[model samples]
Target: MSLDEVRDEARAFLSDHFPKWRKENNARGDLDFEQQRSWQRYLYEHGWGVPTWPIAYGGRGLGMLESMVWNAEKVSAGAHTFFNLVGLGLAGPTIIARGSDDQKARYLPALARGDEVWCQLFSEPSAGSDLGNITTRAERIDGGWVVNGQKVWSSGAAESDRGMLVARYDTSLPKQQGLVYLLADMHAPGVDVRPLRQIDGGAHFSEVFFTDVQIADDDLVGGPGDGWSVAMTTLTNERMSLGGGFGTFAMSFDEVVDIARRTGRIDRYGLVDIYARRTILDVLNNRVQSKLFAGQIPEAEGSVIKLLMAELGTLTADVAIDALGAGGMLAAEAPSAQQRFLGSHAMHIGGGTDEIQRNAIAERVLGLPREPRPDKEVPFKDQLRS
Candidate 1:
């Protein structure tokens, strides 16, 4: 089928399913587990869930433009691709790029179908953006490796089936050269997941502890000492996945304008400025998406999108509240507005922090002086920790 036909069919299906399903669940947040699973199964059956993957792996083998159209149709219908964001977007693509045939055959279909969920175990107490600084150790043994470590800020770890893990396999080498990436079974013995309470009253972020947990040799993604390269694939794509929606600002902008217009506060809310800024960002985001569709990941584009989105979301929320006017303070959208404001705070932290992204844009994208890394050449055993 042509891309437009595929989108039209998807639109018809989503129109039939979404509105009633959303009303039944009353979920302003993410859909519940069963609701998500049923929808995912429907999409899988229709070959729409993992559109970018090969047909052999339960995808539609769609081209980039088709994939874009499919996502647009779903979003326009308010149908989310819930339950498989991490699996399909991050883990699945990374596996396709780096995993072995056995690994791909074993894991890809399950992940695509949402039978197994995955989390990332890259960050630790001492490592967030500086992932090379992680202290997680994996000791080589007879059949596999035994791991012992604590990973913090793991999203969805509490409910995950597996995780993509990076641990030090040769502490004798330099920090970045000693790492290995592995697929860890979250349900394996000696694995512990504890959720951390956040200011938003959600415990989605978790602490994962692996005490003598064993991972098979076959679980490795790239060869030993290749973790950094393998990991960069996931990280780079993560930035795109998180911020690609900035191109769709018009929908959100229209919603905000409608609320203000109904409340009769459009002039008082300084919406003109909001409109101008949002339109510029929307155009920039479109260009970024076009580059993405053409297979050129333009330098600094993701960082630019992420930074602007964080700034724009916060600004939009504040303006929306003001636009609601005094009597509208107690309006139905007030709580949702407050929730969105609080949620936008996380956009600055997740994927990569604003400070980290700005530094990346400065050093890597722009022709700026790179920051000095005293430990870049130091052996892992001798490297000083700040």
Candidate 2:
């Protein structure tokens, strides 16, 4: 089918099976796990879930443009905004780029069908901003490897089947050189998952503890020392995934505009400035998102896109508060209005903190001198963490 036809078909499918599934409303705040599975199965059957993924590994094999169209259509149709964000957007791409053939065959189909969820095993108590300083260790065992460490802020692990884990494999080597990336079995004997209740009163993110957990040799993504490069693939996918537009939610710019007009605030001097800023950001965000979908931007530019999104999100939320006044903070509203602000607040904390993203922009994108690090050369085991 042509790209346009494919997009229309996908939208029609969502309409029939999930008419209320708007982009922003798709998350549904952890309700109805069965329905989530049912919807995912419906998309998989229609070949719409992972459209641009390779066909050999249970994907639709569509082109990049088709995938972009599919994404845009999902948002336009108000399908679920956060459906399969981590699995399809981040972990799926990373595995395809660096995972072994066996890994692909074993995991891709399940992930596409939303049967086996995956979470990132990056980030730790001390390694949040300085990812290279991770102290998680994986010792070569008799047949595979034994992992013992802690990883926090792991999104979607509470229900995830597997985790893409990074650990220190060779302390004799340099910090970055000794790294190794592996697909950790979340249900392994020594693996423990603790759900963290966030300020939003949700448990989407979790802390994973691995104590002498074993991973088979085949679970490794790349060579032992290639973990750093392999990790870049995952982070690149994270930025791309985050920088894209959300189409699944029902409320959109058009709806927002309509509301402004109805409330007699479209041209109100104060509201006009708010709408103008949002309007400008909406346009710029779309353009950049298109570039990302087309693969026009380099991996390093991921930080730039992330920074723009963070700033835009902050501005948009401020505008909403100004326009809605007290009602914006209310927990109840028309079917969709209440959740709109809930989603906007999450934009700042998800993916990475705005401050961390700015550091990435400064050091990676602009080629500015990196911030000073006194422990850049320290051994992973020696770093003090309270």
Candidate 3:
């Protein structure tokens, strides 16, 4: 379908089905877990969920433009797309791009259908931005590998049935090379998950501990020693998804401008400047989306979007706090803006740290001199830090 036609259909769908949830619970137009699951079921049944994937993978096989249109309309109507986020955006894409045929058949349908929720087990207490430094170990045993380690900041772990995890399989090799990727059942005997309470009183972030967790051989993804590259694929999808489809969500640059206008900050606080920057940011966003529509994997461009969005989010929250003044105390009416001000730090920490993203942008995008790693040749076991 043409872009205009797709937009029209999406608008119609939003008008017909989107729920106008309360601001306190529906920031970014997001739904609660149960609400998100039901909404995803409808989208999945109608071939709207995971629309970018092919029909065989339980998607509508829509073009990128159409998918963007659909997302924008949904967000505008306060529709939530939360339930299948990790499954659909991170795990499903990685599996589609890197999983074997059997693996694809096993995971994609359930993920797209929202029958199962998934989380990522990539970060550890010691390896947040420097993921290659993780110490989670998975040793080969009689039938499979025995994993023992702790993973931190895992989103949706409490409810996830499975997770895409990376573990060190061969410490003899370099840390990056010795890794293995596996799909782990969250309910397995040795798996322990504990949610970390956030400043906002939300417990979505979890820390997962594996005590001799046994992963069957069939759960392995990609070839032996291919985990790092496979992980890069997932990370790429993650970085892209983190930024968004544009002009969507309950809070955005547009909302920032709206708030500024409403509070009369537009006259004094350079709201026009924010609007101008948002215009340019939109152009940059569109450029990335155009490349994506052509089937190009946005490598450095993903980091650019991530960094921009991080800055934009902070700017909006800061402006909100400033503009709201006494009104900031009214959490019910301005929940999104108020909460945004309180939790602005997460944007920089989640996905990847802001500093790390800047380094990526500097070296990767601008072609600057790569930072020297003295430990590049060190074996995982021989490395001073475990």
Q: In order, what lDDT does every prediction score?
A: 0.80, 0.72, 0.81
The Cα RMSD of model 1 versus the native structure comes to 3.1
lDDT of 3 at 61: 82
Ranking by lDDT: 3, 1, 2
Question: All predictions: root-mean-square deviation over Cα?
Answer: 3.1, 4.4, 3.5
> What's the CA error at residue 123 for candidate 2, in Å?
1.0
- For model 3 the TM-score comes to 0.90
TM-scores for all candidates: the values are 0.89, 0.82, 0.90
Clashing pairs in 1: none
Off by over 4 Å in 2: 8-31, 247-274, 289-295, 322-346, 363-365, 372-386
lDDT by residue (tens digit), candidate 3, 1-386: 89898889878776765543233335344456776776777777766778889888888788766787787787777674556578888999899999989999999988887889999999999888889998999999977899999999999899999999999999889879999999999999999999999886678799999999999888899876998999999988887676557452225666776777788755355455556656767787788889888888777777777767766667777776677777777877588888777677788788888788889888987889989997767898888874
Give the CA lDDT, 0 to 100, for residue 101 in model 3: 92
Superposed model 1: Cα runs more than 4 Å off? 16-30, 245-251, 258-270, 323-333
For 50-128, candidate 1 gives per-residue lDDT tens digits of 8889988898787666676777787777676557567778899999999999999999988877788889999999998
Give the better candidate number (1 or 2) by lDDT.
1
Encode model 2's per-residue lDDT on 306-383: one tens digit a residue.
555555555444544445545656655332444444555666656677787777777777889987876557665555
